[model samples]
Target: MTIRFAAVSACALLTLAACNRTQEPVAPASAAATPPVESPAIPAADPNALTAEGLGPVRIGMTRADLVKLWGEDSQPNAVGGPDPETCDEFHPAKAPADVMVMIQNGVLTRITLTRGATIKTDRGFGVGDSAMAIKQAYGGAIVAQPHKYQDAPAEDLFAWPHGGATTYVTDPAARGVRYEIGGDGKVMKVHAGDPSIQQVEGCL
Candidate 1:
């Protein structure tokens, strides 16, 4: 009887242990979360003005001394290419575009030229590498289309006065204006803007 009681007590203990183990709750797994990053904003670039009046800060009537002030007088200006030695040589300034060339005659800024690689443009937004046909299409019938002095296929040298006057860039009291020199490819090779001095087919002889 004592042995049977001991066996019954052991069975009761085992059943209680099993019940306790099954009743215990399981813990959930934890995860780490990451946040998103924001990007910085960019500023807008300043617009440059090119017209018959001038090219950017260089005006048609500005004095040679004034140019020195703007372009830096680290080196003296060379003699202009035309008949007059007074004009400065077509040299590029560090501040100006790579293709830009400033011309001064009688100590006054007479012309500003734009060749390949220049980003600045006329108020009309015209610049080098533009098509001759594109220019005609944009300006309409007001432009004067001239034949290139050298090229045979495409009529290269094209002249226009978007400001509504037969302006001159030659000599004398040079008038305010601009001119476009296109190449055989029908694309503009040069964009000249300034006083009448800019009209010269070639720089001072």
Candidate 2:
């Protein structure tokens, strides 16, 4: 894949609540790829405001019943290749305005991904189509940029979450709770929320 495409996927995947242990994630290095020139203009988002903690009534630690009660029965309540397939339940919230996906692990919600032109934005006010530079400026140095696994660019991963404790001291990969996926063209394309599980790329293999 192109370096920018790889970065795009990583950022998008991470935001979709796919992540690793607390240690800063390292994107796989590209042996023969160049940096993306500029991010292209992506679709506008759904404008459903959300929090770093979650979107609307859904919170990170909520349960299946809670979701069912709030959203009724999910049309697809299972993601076969999810981090914990046996325990993971995926959903596409019917009443939501955006293209939303939620995953529950071990009976508690773990991730929420917005795609297909969902205009959801965090309480911080970042959303799809925003420039990486704009996001970096808005967060003001809190982001931990990671190399794209297959890209030659400097930062394919812009991360935000809580860390720095003996228990969480860089080992709880999920601590970097949110990711804003920037495409080769440099604009945000996807937004993800949840814990370390959000770091996942291709699903549990």
* Cα lDDT tens digits for candidate 2, 111-182: 787765877777678878788898888877677676555555533756777442122223463353677777
Candidate 2 minimal-lDDT segment of 10 residues: 162-171
TM-score of 2: 0.64
Clashing residue pairs for model 1: 81-204, 82-204, 82-205, 168-196, 169-196, 169-197, 170-196
Q: What lDDT score goes with residue 191 in model 2? A: 75
Backbone clash numbers for all candidates listed? 7, 24
How many angstroms is residue 205 displaced in model 2 relative to the true structure, after the best TM-score fit?
A: 5.1
* Candidate no. 1 TM-score: 0.66
lDDT of each: 0.71, 0.67
TM-score for each predicted model, relative to the true structure: 0.66, 0.64
Which prediction has the highest lDDT against the true structure? 1
Tens digits of per-residue lDDT, candidate 1, 6-29, equal: 999999999999888855577766
